[model samples]
Target: MDNNYLIIRIDEQQNIELHYFWPSSMKIKYNYPTCITIHFDNLSSCFSLVSLCYCFNILSTSHKLYIGVEVFKAYLSVKFSQSYIQE
Candidate 1:
């Protein structure tokens, strides 16, 4: 069976959007003050935050969080790719 997942994205304006594509498709959009405060019931879903600086093409004032997420995503991609290659 394929793993079903959801993606939560927070825009620069603090708008939140939930994307799900598997078994069914749905999108829920709203506004939230902080991206970190958002919660998800699914333990297998992926969460991401998009700061305004990056969206507006401005130099990000902070890199710690963004870099961390990028690294994690890259790690997952590599792991998944390797698993498929081995099969």
Candidate 2:
């Protein structure tokens, strides 16, 4: 496990949002809340965050968290039909 990595909360909808990334290079660690958009200071940091999350989720232990789809829907609570932009 990387000490310098971001945790992206996986929710339902089979959607993998580019939630955050890990930047071990920083003096202080960064944290992003679920459902909130993250703005990183560097370009590489952003890429590193996504790459790690994708790989980790794929290779990590076979837990119910990853296997359960209903859990994600309950956690994220995002409707597919809903748009981010306001009318």
Clashing pairs in 1: none
- Top lDDT hit: 2
Error of 1 at 31 (Å): 42
In model 1, the Cα lDDT at residue 71 comes to: 35
Off by over 4 Å in 1: 1-61, 82-87
Candidate 1 weakest ten by summed lDDT: 34-43
C-alpha lDDT values of all predictions? 0.34, 0.35
Cα lDDT tens digits, model 2, 1-87, are 343322443334434343334344645444442232223223344345534554345433433233233323323334343322211
What is the overall TM-score of model 2 with all chains considered together?
A: 0.23
What CA root-mean-square deviation does each model show from the true structure?
15.5, 10.9
Off by over 4 Å in 2: 7-16, 25-59, 62-76, 80-87
